[model samples]
Target chain A: MTGVLTVVGLGPGDARWLTPAASEALASATDLVGYGPYVDRVPGTPGQGRHSSDNRVEVDRARFALDLAARGARVAVVSGGDPGVFAMAAAVFEAVENGDPAWRNLDIRVEPGITAMLAAAARVGAPLGGDFCVMSLSDNLKPWEVVEARLRAAVAADFVVALYNPISSARPWQLGAAFKIVSEIRAPDTPVILARAVGRPDERIRTEPLSQVEAASADMSTIVIIGASTTRLIGRAEGEAPYVYTPRFYGVRP
Target chain B: MTGVLTVVGLGPGDARWLTPAASEALASATDLVGYGPYVDRVPGTPGQGRHSSDNRVEVDRARFALDLAARGARVAVVSGGDPGVFAMAAAVFEAVENGDPAWRNLDIRVEPGITAMLAAAARVGAPLGGDFCVMSLSDNLKPWEVVEARLRAAVAADFVVALYNPISSARPWQLGAAFKIVSEIRAPDTPVILARAVGRPDERIRTEPLSQVEAASADMSTIVIIGASTTRLIGRAEGEAPYVYTPRFYGVRP
Candidate 1:
């Protein structure tokens, strides 16, 4: 039996945001695997074997998806936003390398989906249009040294930075530290945008200076941090949320 | 009459890609204004006023939208991708600044949409997940000196870069010039991605080295350029497409 694995991206929460291509791939799968919340967000028949777990079990989940594929099941590994942006696609590929040789023959492909960074960019204006980078401030998986080095590089490069997993319950001050590191390299006047709970109800987006982003309001579920390059502020009134965007250096201010 | 203007984003050409929020905004408009091709993409509506023109006529369209709003008509100024990304939203505001003071009282808002860059990023892998920057190679509006300076800065800063509008029919070699500038500051081994006509039926995505990319086929409709920092060739296969990515620095490659 031929087994195949497809990774699908479920866009920022709303069922309406789900692309038809993504939905069809999920509906055709014989088995589904993913982190718990993401798996739950998938709407469809539950008869397919479902494997879900907390975020901590990535390796285990990867193993499950590969194991199912090895056993001739068409598996769908789902992720919120796009699967490749700090998501599960890499884990599955890594598992293929570490698993039994029999799994090597199985086909695997990654399908694209709308990512939160893209969603957040849309929610605000084109902050990511020109030069921008996406980084996660969460220290749970990597050391601060690595994150700090990247942030410093991002600042010097004048690349707009989109921060992910900014502040969680246990990592309250991680975002502050990242900001400080960025502030050291970039000007205090650099615009910082905080997008809270993107794609979900109660979504909040605001842009301020790198020096003034108070962490008291940021939580783990939020994505935050600064914009660089051509980003600028325009005078927009209340009820008309202002979105900050960097014009393409081409002199086009789209 | 309370004239209102809502700037809507039409994500990358496909009708299915249109967000519900953007669709609803367009549906409610009494006057629709945008570049001719973008205006034509929407379904025809009876009794709705339409304003369309060539690229050079954007400022004219902005004036039209503002004028309609001043007359108390609900207007939706549509832009391809996000209006804020080198689009018409800023032009509208700039027009308001230069126009009669009476129009200042009308409400104006910018509704976000998916950008071409994000869509292109998703088509590939995580080449943009880390610190990245975006730049346009168009010199018609800006001098080559400024573009070269930013390229040097981005290279020194170790940024993954996304290049937009790298070539046009009249300016066929602008991308080659950008490649030469960045190559001076970056290693020849650095990866470069060319995403052409993204999200459209003829979309083409290819990854190569900065040294070899000038020979790569491209057009004015293309987006091109290099990836720096942690960008690496994930895998290369004969007769198969190459894959490039910026490792999720937050964790060990699982």
Candidate 2:
């Protein structure tokens, strides 16, 4: 009996952003596995077994799901945002490449979901409307040198930069370091967006100039967007949030 | 009788990829406006009106939507993929910033959707799992020199690159030009993915080595992805497609 392992993305936060495919995948899953919070988001399906673990042990969780699938259990590995973007899809493939050889033959599929940057970008207007770069500031997997080099190149290339995993208690200064690099290469008044828990009830979205951006406000839930040379902020009425966007016309304004 | 203009993304193509928020917006919209094909994808609602036009007339379509909203009509400007990513969201915002001052005060919201690159990446096993850049190769709006410089910088930084609008009838030579630049900075054996019309019935996904990629295989519906230095392709059984992923460890095997 060939079992199936479908990795699912739960979108950023809201059920409204969830795709029908992901919702259906979750509904039909006999076994669900993922980080505690992501798995908790899915409503209980009677008789469906749930296996939740810490996000740090991605490979172990992946292996456990693969093991279940290999034993004829249809499993779904849930992830926040699109599984392919700094999420569970890569981890599952890594497990397959290095784990039991027979595991490679199992049916595996990844269902895409709305990523944080897109959801966050929507709330603040179209800040990622043009060419852009997405990078994780977390240095747990790679050296900080790699992040610095990539940031410099993206800025030079004039791609709007979206930074994931911006800061955590362990590496609080990383966001500031990124801002310092951006300050050097781009204009001080360029638009900056900090969107925290965008789709959830406690969602907060703010727009500030690159020079005065409040880096300390960002948490694990925050996604930071640094505008390119052409990124702009359109002012609205008093007490109203500004609309942030990067025009498709490249260096020119509307 | 203040009206609302909601910019909604319809994902790549399939209804399964469509989000509930987009569906609700489409259903409630008094007027729908977009490129002819994208607008046609939305199921017609009784008493609802649609304004479809050529893809080239983005700003004009945006203005029409704004005009409808300003006249107390609930309007939805439909777009393929996340409206923020090289789609209609920026165009609408551009229209607002330049059109009428009163347009800025009208209630405008952008609902996000799964962009093409993410959908394409998911089907190919997470080629965009790590640091990445999204760029459009069309030189219609921006100069070719800008595209050339950005491509060079993106490759030098070892960021996985997802190129949109890779080729169109008017810009037949651009994709080849980009390939030449990429070949100079990266290994020829780098993985390349050609995902055309993902999620749609006619979707076709093909992977190749950078040196052997068929530039002519792409059309306007296609999205081209070039792997980074650490990206790998895991071979499967005969006739089975391989899984391509960039590990989170960055330049290191898991």
Per-prediction interface RMSD? 4.4, 1.4
Candidate 2 regions with alpha-carbon error over 4 angstroms: A252-254, B252-254
True contacts kept of 2: 0.87
DockQ of model 1, rounded to 2 decimals: 0.30
Off by over 4 Å in 1: A96-109, A121-130, A139-143, A182-190, A236-254, B88-111, B140-142, B185-189, B229-238, B250-254
Chain B TM-scores per candidate, in order, are 0.91, 0.98
Best by lDDT: 2
CA lDDT, candidate 2, residue B9: 95
Question: What's the C-alpha lDDT at position A212 in model 2?
Answer: 94
Residue A206 in model 2: shift from native, Å? 0.7
Q: Evaluate every candidate with DockQ and list the scores.
A: 0.30, 0.79
Q: What is candidate 1's lDDT per residue for B1-254, written digit by digit as tens?
A: 49988888787766656767678889889889888888898785788888887885666778888888988899999988766655676566666655766656677777666566666665655566555556666676567776676667666666677776677777777677777878888877788877787778888888777777763487755666477655765453356554455655445753
